[model samples]
Target: MVLAFLTTFLATRFVTHAIRSGRGPFRDASVGGVHVHHEVYGIFLLLGSGTAEFAYRPGGGWGSLLAVLFGAGAALTLDEFALWLHLEDVYWSREGRSSVDAVLIALVIGVLLLIGANPFDADRSAGEGVVALTLLVNLCAALVAILKGRVVLGVVGVFVPLVAVLAALRLARPTSPWARRRYPAGSRRAARSRQRFPPGRRNRWDALVDLFASVPHGTRPRTATPTEPDPEHTR
Candidate 1:
């Protein structure tokens, strides 16, 4: 799965760059005068692979191949997730950054799965009750983190229960539900959270994202032009 994802991602990026730079004969795919996004193909692949897996209950080599297909589909779909969300050609806009974030998140989750890190780490000798209890506790922690809007942390924490617990206990992002409801405006807790995640910190994070994601030039939000006062009003 990891190999499939990386292969598709890199190949897509390379082709896109080559086309953009006029170094490749390849052009954007279109039909009936409408541009076709790769996500369409991705959706089909996912559906086909999922159906094949379910119908045949494929195992061994066939199962691995199906998994690869699914991963490839996931890569293509997530690469244009922001376009689906905005229902526009935001592929080269600031909104496109979401696609990069999604890819990174998917990669992290895939790595965790590959590592075989189980969330429910109870021993078989510990009995069924103990195993169930452990799973329940981890689930609750993961739920709390997710509810607090630490989605990435919550997802990754599923494989590391302690991380979920810590994230759940920590202050939520300033704009998250937990912060808005639990840390009221002007409250000390809110103020502290704001300090921790200041505007500057967000800007720095954005810089890192741009650096890693290789965001296209001119995609950043444009500054609004300042309007001059009317001559009559000024006089």
Candidate 2:
């Protein structure tokens, strides 16, 4: 219960902080086939955590801990599902191929999480351990996908953390190199490099970093106002 509240409180506060600091919320270009409004996303994550902890039931050995973990995971998965239900426009803007690829990745990982000993259903003592371990694995997988430009893959990678990790990665991953380069200053890329690659990569996040790094900084796309603020504010 406390963890969920803290997480939600911290996440919400962070977004508020970003906005106050002049980093107002912006739309995410990699919406693929689903859209997630940032406001609602935070609400659900906070609620999910609360519900999961409240639903926790004690059990023997690893059973008790697993109960709490599953409840929590359920809360998180519910939050992720909400993203799919609420936002279609942002999720589907990319190439058809990327959307399809993301679904495939989700299916594969979802199956893995559901099967393979079912961490959520483990003995209570082992459940906590299982949840923790799976969370680690999920985090590693998500990081790998983000660096590789697999936006959909990264989004789907959060199953273990009830999609929290995936959400976190989305917020953390650079939206565009141009934006980042400009924000920090002194990090500008040379002009000759900008011409070699397209401005927006297949995924907005990738293109931003890749294009900026490959081409000169001046030629990159200006950070347009986002259509909807990013739901995964942690990134």
C-alpha lDDT of all candidate models, in order: 0.73, 0.42
Maximum-lDDT candidate: 1
- How many clashes (backbone atoms < 3 Å, residues ≥3 apart in a chain or on different chains) does model 2 have? 31
Question: What local lDDT score does residue 92 receive in model 1, on the 0 to 100 scale?
Answer: 55
**When superposed on Cα atoms, how far off is each prediction in RMSD?**
8.6, 16.0
Candidate 2, residue 211: Cα displacement in angstroms equals: 24
lDDT of 2 at 194: 39
Q: Which stretches of candidate 2 lie over 4 Å from their true place?
A: 1-102, 113-121, 124-235
> Tens-digit lDDT track for model 1 on 52-159?
999998899999999999989988888887888888766655787787678777888889888887665556437878878777887788888887778778878877
Error of 2 at 210 (Å): 20
Q: 1-235, model 2: which lDDT tens digit per residue?
A: 3244234434533443343344666323236434333445544544654565467633474444444444344333432342355444222223212333432344455556546624345465456776788767877766655553445555555544445454434422243443344334333233322332346535564453232123122322324346543443311
